[model samples]
Target: MNLAILDGGTHYHREAIYGDRYRSRFDRAIYAPDLVLADLEDVGLLIVPDRIDPVLLRRHRALLDDFLRRGRTLVVLGGNEAETWVPGVDWAFRPLNYWWWLDKDAVPVQQLVTPEHELFRHLPFADTIWHFHGILLPPTGAKALITVPGDPGNGDLGGALIYEDCVTTPGRLIISTLDPFYHHGSHFMPAATRFLDGFLNWARHIS
Candidate 1:
């Protein structure tokens, strides 16, 4: 399958990850006014990584909607207001706790709700344990692949960290609040590297 990445051109993390390391695996579709459907015509999978400008994505929302309607896959990473551009996706921001692991009795917030899913075959749940920037309140019929348990006291009905939505459009949508690319590309977070090793491999072979 032909894969492509939306390069926002404003982040070094994107350059290190998509441009340098996985250059041969994906074609770059620079984020600009010229990025039209023609640029994604032959692409089977389009990756919108973390840190992409939400305003730019909003400007091309129609193009993205059209891409999905054409039976193409779309994968979105974390750190943006996806609700602004992506149809049926509602995101809620949460405070970051980089030191969550510091607590000796800390429980991992990330949970693999679908342990039998094929994605786990490539990426073990442990590799997905890093902190998330927010949570996704996915639309009805979307599978919550990974979830964070709700906190009843705070009235926070915790939501999905990773979800797969096949009901939103003709094609598939795999989205996550986990920003592995940003962490891995920055030369930190070993788990992020592990996530990419498996995620990219799984992405390459998915139909």
Candidate 2:
């Protein structure tokens, strides 16, 4: 698939987990304190996980933009509070209720906004309901795949948990606040494992 994942020194356990789960088709590159542009060659998709060095990413923003200008894909799986590295995204931090599933008769508020999108071909709704880091306000003409349910009284309580921005740049960008890789590596969330498996397959086919 020629996928490359940028490691921020937090995905160490992913090696062992992937070895046991399924063979990953993606390569990993250290997010060296100083980002290197050459590491991205021949990669169709670039994955940026959580805890990425925003400063380093910002320093090399032009390179990323140029990469996108060639119609490559970028998958960003984190929330950035200080700055926008993914371009055309406005982030809002939400207090996550991790234990919400433990409660009796609990129902997830996150809903699939674009149920017919091809991105959901491999990924089911159940695999995406675990937890998310925050919400995203994507740019115009973007497709929001998942969002919290809106409340009539509260006036649009739902915000985008996952979305794709094809208009913001020359390439396609799938941005989410869900830390799927971290949870999958730790083996703490079964849904994350399912998510990663399906996501990789989907990306492979898409690319």
List TM-score per model, in order.
0.92, 0.87
lDDT by residue (60-178, candidate 2, tens digit) is 67877877888999887774342365578788667788889998899888888798999799889888878778788777899899987656596655578888889978899888888
Best by TM-score: 1
- Per-residue error for 115 in candidate 1, Å, reads 1.4
Model 1: per-residue Cα lDDT over 4-110, one tens digit each? 77776756555555566666666555565458878988888988888777888899999999989998999999976788888899988788899898899999978
Q: Which sections of candidate 2 miss by over 4 Å?
A: 11-23, 27-34, 80-83, 151-157
Clashes of each: 0, 0
Q: Which residue ranges in model 1 land beyond 4 Å of their true spot? A: 18-20, 27-34
Cα lDDT of candidate 2 equals 0.74
On the 0 to 100 scale, the lDDT of residue 132 in model 2 is 76
